[model samples]
Target: MLGQDPDAAQELMHSWAAQLSTRAQAAAELSDRVATIASSAVGANGAVRVTVGASGALTDLRLDDRVQRIPGAELAITIMAAIARAQAGLTEQVSIAVHDTVGTDSETGRAITDTFARRFPKPADEQPDRSERDARDGW
Candidate 1:
């Protein structure tokens, strides 16, 4: 119907353009929020803690004096486990961001969620606790 009326066609096009612009703006805002998201997790009964950015890059790591009791190799494992735990939770944090912004139904949201899921699949929950392991070994 709008084909024969140039003014109507123009108006229709303008409406579509406005909708597209709104979507683009929302996506941009979502990207900014997601980029700023930082996830943290603790492991080995809080002896090791780590924070990771949206890119799963380690941003901060904190080890209390309790770590001095850990063997060098065990400490390395603990640190890595903490990082993995942080990375694993990154997706959920980003999922909330996406849901609040563009929403999970959008293609952009799905892609963002999928990428994080693949990059930081959950770690095994059976990671040995520092105290328990040490006690078992009579350390």
Candidate 2:
């Protein structure tokens, strides 16, 4: 009502429509980039390899012939580690893509990156021993 001259109202509506169109285009492009996201990693000594998709779902896995040299449990651990690394790589790619598309400071970008970061936290250097901590703290 404050700025409701007919021509001014028409111009304001046009500006709002243009802004919405731009956002729609940007979202579409981001979707396209995410749809193609993938990352791969190989385990130490090349015994295992893995690839993960945008959602951190495993798309491929490979085991070198040398994997037979390791015990079954060790080999399984190696494979799981490789898959985790691959998923981490995929999360990094998604973060970059979201930053590029929506700007890291924007609400959409922060939401996207924060979700991935929470879901795929960086591996810790060493896990704390709960028993040791409890003993030291007199728990």
Q: What is the C-alpha RMSD of each candidate to the true structure, in Å?
A: 2.3, 7.4
Tell me model 2's lDDT, rounded to 2 decimals: 0.74
The number of the candidate with the highest lDDT is: 1
**TM-score of decoy 2:** 0.81
- Candidate 1 lDDT for residue 10: 96
Q: Model 2, residue 126: displacement in angstroms? A: 7.1
- Residue pairs whose backbone atoms clash in candidate 2: none
What does candidate 1 score on TM?
0.88
Model 1, position 56, has a per-residue lDDT of 94
Off by over 4 Å in 1: 132-139
In candidate 2, what residue range of length 10 has the lowest lDDT sum? Answer: 125-134
In model 1, the worst 10-residue window by lDDT is 124-133
lDDT value, residue 38 of candidate 1:
92
lDDT, candidate 2, residue 112? 80
Name every residue pair that clashes in candidate 1.
none
Error of 1 at 90 (Å): 1.2
